[model samples]
Target: MVISSQKENDVLIKPDKVIKYKNSNIILNISNLSIGYDKKVIAENISFNLKKGELVAIVGVNGIGKSTLLRTIGGFQTKISGSIQIEGKELTTIDTLDLATKVSVVLTEPIASKNMSVKELLALGRQPYTNWLGKLSDEDIAFITKSVSLLELTPFLDKKCYELSDGQLQRVMIARALVQDTSIILLDEPTTHLDLYHKVQILKLLKSIAHKTEKTILFTSHEIELAIQLCDKMLILDGRTNPFEEPCKLIEHKNFETLFPADMISFDANSGSFKIKK
Candidate 1:
């Protein structure tokens, strides 16, 4: 795959602190991406490149197509028209299983399994690498063990999935994705239906994972302030307009507050922070 990277030796460029990649870093490139359902266009002309280990937060009002964007990125939507590439390779050109091995996803909806345990749910992530019958190898077990522990789920390993709280369940889902061992992780409204505290906890957890594990994580969130505080970058959509960026340098260009909140509030450009734009 042909991933692009900014020259680290360039004194003018700030260092990218996203996750570390093996051999060399490959930035994921999404170009002219358009997505839709059977009868309607959800979004179009979307383009961006993500550096390895970067954490991106997407924000848009309800029905603004944020989740649709993540679905397109994860290959879950079939009605997309555009190109997605990782490390210089076109995403559509790769095999589905190969794609699975390269990307993992978590959705906001709770996973339902009347008979599964937390351990089993996490183990399912290794299916892409396992035998046809989904048999676990020693390597799979090792990944599962590490993932659960990272989520602090060791005490609940054998506990039934249905018995866990919403917070615990979210962690289990994340652990499942981690065990999949993919370079890109997509989460669709991960904070949905969460209490305020759990919402903060989950976003914080994602930020920590991006820093410690060096994983490329992109998730949709409605918690605007929280997302801005913890995410390395932000992708924002306003109605039928294009997606604009909130990078470290170009944040003001987005005109963030007025995009969603319809008020004449003001934001300070000096601090590189935001408030309601007046």
Candidate 2:
């Protein structure tokens, strides 16, 4: 597959160079992936390579296994078949401790400690590197500080999680993942329960983080239009053919048109957004 950048002027004219560069930069590789419970597959034959510094989105209609795919990649659920690789190493070979250092996940699950301060919650991300007594090293402290600053959480550091708004808490959770210092970050519905402005704000922050830190940020989103505008690449999981490509290429190939039923909605390739059918 040809890897296209978001820039309209930049084009990959040489296939060989694109392949070589993609191979060297890939952070996560999924091949022939089938995800489900008890051998009942929800989706199958999924294949994609996520490169470093790319912000990708997994989008599909509800109940189409978007969360199932993310869960499988995060190693929280068992894959029915196929392989997942992180930085060229098979995911199965990586131990839990090692995996923590490679990938950080932010799920939609509610935090148990509503009274925990933002700083305390973010510091928990360093558990993989902490001593048996759960003490942070100087480096760990620095990481936490950097994460707090990166997400601009200094003002909320002392605030309890329960007191923060949904958007604020989501940023705190993302900061926690960032403090984990992983190369790949997986988030499930990061924009859930937020207003339109906050949703855009969060996605823009993620896009900036991916580009600035050279990290692969993959999240599942119901905000398809916003994702198409912000993400560098997109993975469409429509149950028939899962296609992972640059947003423009996916549109060019007419992949988005098959995403939903035609009776109510239709994809507009020119606008790169879905529209209500008249």
C-alpha lDDT of candidate 1 relative to the true structure = 0.76
What is the C-alpha lDDT profile of model 2 across 1-278, one tens digit per residue?
Answer: 55655333222213332223334567788877888998799999889989889999999889889999888888898888877878777777789999999999999999997999998999899999998988999999999998888899999999999999999999999999999999999999999999999999999999999999899999999999999899999999988778999999999999988888888899998888889988
Give the TM-scores of the predictions, in the order they appear. Answer: 0.83, 0.91
lDDT of 1 by residue, 97-180 (tens): 999898999986657664699878888899899999999999999999888777899988889987888788888899899999
TM-score for candidate 1, residues paired by index: 0.83
Q: List the lowest-lDDT window of 10 residues for candidate 1.
A: 9-18
Clash tally for model 2: 0
Poorest lDDT segment (10 consecutive residues) of candidate 2? 10-19
RMSD of 2: 6.0
Residue-level error in angstroms, candidate 1, position 95: 1.5
Instruction: lDDT for model 2, please.
Output: 0.88
